[model samples]
Target: MTAITGTVYDSSGQPVEGVNIQWSSNEDPPVSSHERGSRTIDDGSYRLVLHRGSWDVHGTKDGTGTEVETVVLGADDAVVDLHFP
Candidate 1:
């Protein structure tokens, strides 16, 4: 498993809390969504442990809109930050 961590920010560059972070794998056998997501805490930080593969990470909030980022994880961990505009 690869560890992915990052923070979410709004258009004004402020940390956003309670943001839902989700990811979809690009592998041949897709991963289940049940274990592929996280929610940002008070500090806007979130982490996900995912199988090594290509993934599209998405961050969403009720009124803040959504942001997406693509990441390729191998043996090393990754850091992907999401910022909404």
Candidate 2:
């Protein structure tokens, strides 16, 4: 398993609170790949745990903006920090 984390901010560079994050990985195949995610805390920080592999990560905020990243996870837990400007 791998551990990914990061902080969220707005265009003004202020910490955003109560942001929504979508985290998912290849579940079956092209036929079906479940999309799972979580929301950030009041401090604008969040974390997700997934299996070691290549997965796509996306962070979204309502009425704000969204950030997407293609991550290649390794056997050891990895930390994916994101800075949305």
RMSD of each: 1.9, 3.0
Candidate 1 wrongly placed segments (more than 4 Å): 34-36
lDDT of 2 at 71: 73
Tell me the TM-score of model 2: 0.72
Compute each candidate's TM-score over C-alphas.
0.88, 0.72
lDDT of 2: 0.66
lDDT of 1 by residue, 1-85 (tens): 9999999998899999999888888777876453336899999999999888889888888856566788989999999989998
lDDT of 2 by residue, 36-60 (tens): 4667788788787777677666666
Best by lDDT: 1
At residue 50, give the lDDT of candidate 1.
Answer: 88
